[model samples]
Structure formats: structure tokens, C-alpha cells
Target: MPDAAPPPAATPLAPVPRLDAAALVAALRAHTGEEFELVGPLPGGQVGAALVRRPGRREEVLTHWGGASDATWARVARTGALLERARDAGIPAPRYALVARLPERIAVVQERLPGEPPTRVDLALVQEMVAIAGRGAGLLRERRDVPAAELHLLRSGPGFCLHESLAQYDERTRRLLDLVRRIGTGHASRMAGDDLVHLDFHPGNVLVDRTGTVTGVIDWDSVGRGDHRFALVTLRFDLAVPGTGAADRSARAAATRWLDNRIDDLFGASPDGAATLRAYWAHMGLRQVDWAIRHHGPDDVDRWLTVAAARLA
Candidate 1:
């Protein structure tokens, strides 16, 4: 008998196109029927932003929310609606003018708020932003809207803490994960609230003027209903990440102290505040460590683990 023919190999999936400045500019021009001059790229985590100047219009930011599944896009739509509510409440957020849902990517054109991200984050400005966020939270509390399944705390989605990534780390990190797992058991209940939370409330997402006034709090893609205090803890960890530049490092140190003071104040306000803070800390720690494991190298994981350990202690 003749030898059986070899089976065909599976076809490889095509790589997704990079959402660079040129690509974004083209996409914007195509979707909006307007010409755009690329200004520069803005810092982002899950998404990418570009500053573009349209003819006879103020500078606008075009955010490329990269390709996502339909479910994820649904969540983004809900988040956009929530942000609209927040903006109506006078929160410093952008106005979404156009949202283009394409086959391979999503692009949003937003009104560019004035001021730049502070080279050195001022704690006073951070506090003001947090207060504004709290008011937005209050608005969310009145509306009994539930986010999509993917936006839930326990969902194994991007930015949500998952346990599988812990296996990629060292012994010390594993030990920390043990504590985190224990603390996370009833965390959903503890964190349950109607307040809208910015899951990534870091300094980079906050825009400030020359006088250190927070002009806008950008990046509301991960906005959802949760305990507002959870965001405060996320900001604490964000301020502690080691930066590559001298100014950033100095800012991190000062901001860390400021966050520490804020945490202390929270603890002093209520007897159970410590436990609540610890739970939120574990959630933030897991979120950071898991994110580092996937997107960064061992050194980054170690740096985040150090922050996690300090919080656990």
C-alpha cells in the first residue's frame, strides 16, 4: 500500500497591524472625512493615543483602542456611556466625539483637554483628582447600572487579577500570592459598591497645568462600579513604581510618601479600614504582578513584587 499522504499543517493566523501614528492618522481621516496632522504619541497601557491637529479645529486626541472581541467592545461602549455621565457631572474627562468600530480596531476621537501631564506629580493635585472621582462615584451610585460580565471584579480579563500568573514567579512571590489568595476569597463582597472606579488611576492618566492644577483625568476605559477606595489603593501602587528618569524617580519617592500618609489617614478613620485597605492592596498587588509577568520581564516583576510585599507587611 502507498504511504499515506502527510496531513496539512494549520494555517498561521495573520498578525494584527500596529496602531502607529501613521495608521491612526489614516484611520481618522478615513472615518471622519477630515485631514489630520500627527502631533505625537501619548503614553498608554492597553490602548494607544495620538495627538492630531485637524484643519480648522482645536487639537484632538485619537485613541486607538486596538482590536478587541465583540464582548469587549460592548463593555467599552458601556464605559463610554458611564464616562458621559461622569462628564455631565462636571468631572474632568474628555468628550467622545466619534467612535469608529472597525473590523480589526476601534478608534475614538476625543476633545483634547488643556494642560500637560506633570513631570513631577503633586500630591495636592492627586488629592483633588481623587475628590472629583469621588463625586463621579456618587453619580454612579445613584444609577443601578450593571457593567458587562467582563468588567466584573472576578473576570479573568485584562487588568483584572488572576491567580494563574503567580506560577511564573519566584518563591517569595509565591508566598505573597498565598496571602493574596486568602485575602481575595471574600474580596468581591468587600469591594461591592455602586461607586464608579477607575481601575487604572495613575499619574500618567492625569493631566495637570503648569500651576499643578489637575485639568483632566483621562483614560476611563476601565471605569466600572466598585468601592471607590479601591482606586485610591491602585494610585498608591502606581506612585511607587520605579521610573527610568531622574525627575520621575524623585516624583515616585515623594508621591510614595504622600500615598503612605493618605493610607494612614484612611486607616485612622475607621477600625475596619485597615482590613479593607489590605484587601484592596492584595487586589492591586496581584493585578500589578500578573500584568508585569505578561507584559514585562523578571526585573519588572521583582519591582512589583517588592511593592506587593511592602503592602502585605
Candidate 2:
């Protein structure tokens, strides 16, 4: 029922729990007494998400929270309010309608927003997403209670941005891990500042219409406080990777180059600009590489390796 519990990801990634959609639906019914109909899993999900609807309510996305820690839940608690502020600031992030802490596992019901994941991150979308990042430039400055973003550059993150995958994947990843550790030693451990940080900011998280205008940004599960510029690094890594349906290789490369130039232009002046980017890229390198190792095929891993090798080195 839960997609056959994808064969346990290889060691290191083994800790990463595949989202159990059927179990979540059962948990929702048992705990909330809401008979919601499953509308199948959402596509292009780095992590799993599903669509659900009930008779009287509009469709909402259901996110499984099987492997998140208490700290993660704590962040989720404040996320709703933070998203509200983000909305007020003109960033179209989805709001958490309900966080159901069932015995089976935590399940999050989020407000379903508009648009679909764009097939490609063309120049227009890149510019738009970068502009949207500016809207929440100092969003969390006053929210002293929220946790700053964890880079996990040096160490393994809770379940996602792992280090072992790189250290053990291959010679290429092993070298990348060395650089990550070096950057980690330079003190980029915790992302500092008040700007809103969506750790997983990428094309998959944002939705757009045919004309490529971003309709909404979803998947705020990893939302936290940090220099929003960090998101640029994440987007850069996500865009550079081979997948993403960009039919024209040259165009994809051009878009990524454009974003890289923008990142340099924007972050080059900050005090810790280079250091911070090295750390962000390191974390993203480990995250994407490890994900490819665990969830994708060998060809995918090789493609990721080529992209990561080019950047993290």
C-alpha cells in the first residue's frame, strides 16, 4: 500500500525513511476522524508528498513526517506563523493547515497552492525566484525563538544532508567530503541572520504556469532562519543537476551559469560571502549526491557526480 517501502536505501542513507502514504492516510483517519480521499502522490518530490481531498474542503497536500526529530517538529510549530509573515511580505509559501501527531507518525496537512512544477528553470523563472527570495530578506529577524538553519556541512543532518554518502560513495565524493570538512572547519556550521531560509529551495518546490511565472512556493518543512542568499546556492545545485526535464542541454547550462553569476554578484560583497557559499555548496553537494546514491540509479549518480565534481572542487 505504501509503495512497497522502497528497498531500504543503502547504508548511511538507510536511516532515511521513505514516506509511507497509506499509513499516513490510515493515521489521519484514525486520529482526526476525517475521511479524506487520497488523490495520489505528488510528482517531482525529492521527499514524498500526496494530494488529498474531503467532501467539503479544497484539496490539500499531505506530507509524511516519519523521520523528523523533536527539533524539526518545533520548527514546524512556528512555520505556520512564519509562512503567514512570508505571505504578508509577498512570498507565496504554503501555510500549514494542520499538524497531526498521530501515534503512527506525524502527518502535516498543508494549504494546496496553485501552479505546477515548471519543466525547466529557464531565465525568467530564475529571475523571478531570485526576486521572491528578496521579499523575505529579513523576515525572521524578530523571531528570536526560531532556530537558525543547520548547514550540516561537516556533520550529518538529521536524516537528509548526510555525510557518509559522500565519504563512501566513490573517489569523487570522497574528495568532495574533504572540501566540505575543510569548509566546515572555517565555521559555517549554523546559518546566521534573519532572512528566511528554505533549505530545499529549488525548482521542484516552486510551482509555475505555462508562461513560467511562479504561482506559489511550497514545501516549507525545512523552513528556518538564515541569510536568504543561502537559497541561491541551493537553487544553483538543484539546477545544475542533470534531471529536471530541460530538453536543451545548452539552455540548462546557460540558466545555471546565469544563476551562478547572480550568486557571485550578490554574495561577493558580504563579509563571510565566500565562506558561507562554500559551506552551502558543500551541504548541497552532500545532500544531492547522497540522495542520488540512495534513491536514483547509477547513471543518475554519475551525472550528479559530474555536476558536484565541477562545483565543490
Candidate 3:
């Protein structure tokens, strides 16, 4: 039997959205000529966004709240343009079109790429995307020579990366902060140069087809100049701790093993790569804890923070 091609890289997570579906549809319909049908919801929560199927069309329409900032809509437009540029650059990206932009929301009607939701947290799939992430990192490193700083998630400072700037989070936030400090300060690993990092890479964001063939790597919102190793570590963290308890240990280990080897293949299993990966692991974990605290309620916040604290301890 022929070995199947690996799944595509994960999509970058979007800012949580409180979508106004009706309003978004209205705006989208007004702007586009095609009819869009109501498909089932995407896997993530309502705040995450939904998938709308266009009848007789191979594409999907993704809608999300642009948050409160007046520039949020503009950012969506810019993101679409960037995706187009990336595709032209020979990157594996979905065909994208911006259909509408309202004061409160934005709608992107884009090609629905092949592949199913990631099954069993495969490391090969993770590395497939990490390689792309590294490519993105290389791009950012090249772009650093340009006079202008590209608008990207990497532009956020240490405070944002560490989650120290948000005002509303409480105890959970503090716990995450403490962990961030330990992870960021630990001298185990360090690297210089600002390469692009896709801070979010998980099974939920990745896709794999039935034959294990990776079709297209979607999502580019978080692409920016930063540490590429950090991006790889962020994806690897989820595999390191796949689930809440012992039942998933074997799976986690398998995934980890695959990633460990792949990391070595791409970056080489050298002291420098190891150190760089360690730094990224710490940063990525801290970021997850911060996100859980800020975006989730008491139950989730408490759970993630506890896990984070234990790791730091």
C-alpha cells in the first residue's frame, strides 16, 4: 500500500468572537452575488466562529465578531489580503475572499480545503505545520530588513506574550503570570533573532484527510516575526499533555515521540535547537494558561491555572 500523505498544518486561532449571525449574513449577502446556505456549526464554540456552506459551491463562509475596536473590520480585510499574498507565494493556503465588513463584524467567504479534523493528535501532522511555521518565520526574518513592521501577533510585547497587561483576570491570571515568569526566566534555553511564530497550533486547528494526505494549510492571522522555535514548542505542548488524566498518556507519548524526531530532522537535535524549543515550550504554556483565564469562566480558569501551577512547581 502506498503511504498516505500527511495532513496539512493547523489554522491559527482567531480572537474570540460574539458573532451576530443574522447581521453578518445580511452584510455578506449584500456584498456577494452567490447564495449561502446555513451549514452546521464549526467545532469550536460560538465565540470561536462558524462554518457556512455555500450551495453548489466548494467554498465555505466563516463569520466572526471583529471585537470592539473600530479597526477590527479593517484587520479582517488586511488578513484576507495577506492570505492571498501567501497563496501567491506558494504557501498552502485556502482560496479566500472578503465578502462583507460591518461596524461590529466581518465575514470571509473562503475555499473549504480538504481534510477532516485531526484524529489522535498526530505528530507528523503537527510537524507538517511546524515546517510551514518555520517557513513563515524565515519570511518574517527576511522582512525584518524592511523599514516597516508588519501588523502581526508577534508585534505584541513581552507583557502581552506573558499576559501581564490584561486588566480583568483575577487569581487565574496571577497563577499564569507566575508560571510565565518561571518559564521565561529559566536559563535552559534562549535564542536571538525575531522570526515569525504561529503561537497557536493544535489538533482543533489542524486537518487530516481519510488517507492521511494533507491538502492545504489554512489560517494565517497569527503569522508574525518572532521565534520560530517558540511556534514549534507551542504546538508540541498539547501533545505533551494530551488530556486531563492517565488514559491519554500512551497517546501523548506517541505524539511526543513523533514530534521529538521530526523536530530533530528539521532543526536538528542539537543543544541550540533544544534550548530554543525549551524557551518556546515555556512561553507557549504560559500563553495557554493566560488564554484560559481571560477567555473562560471560573471553572475552566481554575482548572487550567491549577495545571499550570503544578507544572511550574
Candidate 4:
């Protein structure tokens, strides 16, 4: 017999604890009746969790504790339902399946979309996203008669508030919160459509393939009915330079232009719209800062405070 080629090098997978790993394998096998082999840890995101995949399954499965809440679990359910509805409506979305929802853990089996991370945001993709978002908003706005509890924003509200300020918080955070309080209770101007806005639309949240085509947008945790301009503003908030980079200033300018154009084109929102968005940003960002200070250490508290202050400014 011809000699088989040497086995491909094994990837240095991040170690999952022996007990937890065994439990996860058992749970998946029980649910899918197929043994799951460990793949690797998922990319770091705000939500603390790990993921594993099967040898040849089309769906990747995640193991998480925070998402198992009564409210969050429902949101995930609604997300899957919305994606399905969108697909039938000729909207692009990944296939999703809910595998297990245990008392302490939640897992969702989802089809991996075809795309790699994009190198930069292409303007065409931006327009496409806005169009899809517009359609989604229209759908949500039409259904506003639905119970408020069924709304995505209400569920996400408890999750989006700013964290408490820790002792080590920097000066910048103070400025940010002060600005937020100043924003007061202003209402966002009603746009033409009110469907669904992927409130957390950002470059990193979008996926694209090598050809630079957007495959599908992920991270539905923030999907809900709200001002379309809120979505626009969140996408624009990254204008602040991170550390020091050559194009930091240019990036901010481009982001500002993008925000202005999107707001004008999609919503016909005016200068007052900008203030409303900023106020919301300060308020929500401070909520996050508060949560961080309460949960994290000195470094995180300081960083959040500084960013919060900068946002207010």
C-alpha cells in the first residue's frame, strides 16, 4: 500500500478545563447524537463565553452562561425567528438553530456565514447594510403594536446601562457622564421608516470574504426598534483614535463624514439629530462604564472612564 502522507500539524487549541470540556462534549452528544471535537476558543468579545464545533457539522455551537437569562434567551429566540423571516423576505441572513437552553448554559447551533474579516469598510457595503437595515426598521415599526415586552430594545435596556465608577476611574469619564446627564429626555426625530436597526453596526461587527463582499451581519444582541440615527451614531462612535495610529485623524474625519451622510440620506435628520445621538451615546456609554467599574479591576475602570469622558466632550 502507498504510504499515507504525514498527518497535518495539529492546531494548538486553547485548553478548556478537563471537567467543563467533558461536560460540554457530553451535552452536545446528547443533544445532537454526534461526538463533538474541540476546535478553538472564539474571538474575544464583550460577552464572556467559549465556542466549539464538530468535525464536519455546518453549524458552530457556543457555550455561554450570561445568555441563558430569561430575557436574553428570549432575545436569542426572537433573533432566530427574525432571521428566518428576513430570509423568506429575500433578506440575507445566516441559518440558525437553537440546540440547547439549559438552566445555567445556553447553546445555539448556527450556520457559519461565508466571509472573512474585511480589511476596511467599503462604501458599497455601507450602503447595502443601510438598505437592509431600512427594510428591517420598517418591519419593526409596523409591528410596534406588539407587546412592549416582546420588543428587543426593552430586553437590551437592562444589558446596556453604564457601569459604576470605580475609585481608579480617570478624569475623562467624569466629563462623559456629565455630558450624558445634560442630554436629558430628548426624543429622536421620527424617520420615514421604523423597522429594525442593527444598533451595533460597526466594521468589526460586519463580515466579508476575500472578495470584499458582505456575507452576513452577525451580533444580533443589539437588534431592535429604535431611531435609525441611533444606529448611525453607534457606528460612528469609533471615530475616537485608539492608542496612536498614522491614520487616526483621517479615520475620525472619514467616520464623521460617513455618519453625516448616512443620517442625511437615510433619515433626513438635521443638526439636532446629532445632539440627540450624542446625548444617547453619553447616557448609554456611562451605563457601560458603571458596569465595568463594578465588575473589573483598576485598569478597566480607568480606561472606561477616560473613554466615557471623551465621548461626552
Highest lDDT model number: 2
In model 2, where do residues sit more than 4 Å from their true spots?
1-12, 67-73, 243-247
Ranking by TM-score: 2, 1, 4, 3
Error of 3 at 98 (Å): 2.4
Weakest 10 consecutive residues, lDDT, candidate 1? 1-10
lDDT of 3 by residue, 1-313 (tens): 1222132133222344466556566666666765766565566532544577666665474755345355665556655655665565555666665446545555666777777766555545665766666665544444543222221122234323434422235544544455455555554333455554444655655567886556666555555445556555556656644465564566667777777676666556555665455445445555565455445544544454454443344
What are the per-model numbers of colliding residue pairs? 0, 0, 2, 22
- Tens digit per residue, CA lDDT, model 1, 1-313: 1222232243212223335878767876877787788988766544467788877998888876667678767766777788788778777888887687766778777888888887676557667766776775565656675551122224334434655566435555556678876766655533556777777888788888888888888888777776676777878888776677887677667767876887788665987787777777777777777766666556667777878878686
For 102-151, candidate 2 gives per-residue lDDT tens digits of 66457889989988988776777888898998787888878998888888
| Global fold similarity of model 1 (TM-score) | 0.80
- Candidate numbers, best lDDT first, in rank order: 2, 1, 3, 4
Assess the local accuracy of residue 128 in candidate 1 as a C-alpha lDDT between 0 and 100.
76
lDDT of 1 at 71: 72
| Residue 30 in candidate 3, Cα distance off native in Å | 3.7
Residue 6 displacement (Å), model 2: 23
Per-residue lDDT value at 183 in model 2? 79
Candidate 4: how many backbone clashes? 22
- Give the root-mean-square deviation of each candidate in angstroms: 8.5, 5.2, 9.5, 11.7
Per-residue lDDT tens digits for candidate 4, residues 190-246, read: 222455656566656667777667777766655565555555555555433242455
The whole-model C-alpha lDDT of candidate 3 against the native structure comes to 0.53
Task: Give the worst 10-residue stretch by lDDT in candidate 3.
Answer: 146-155
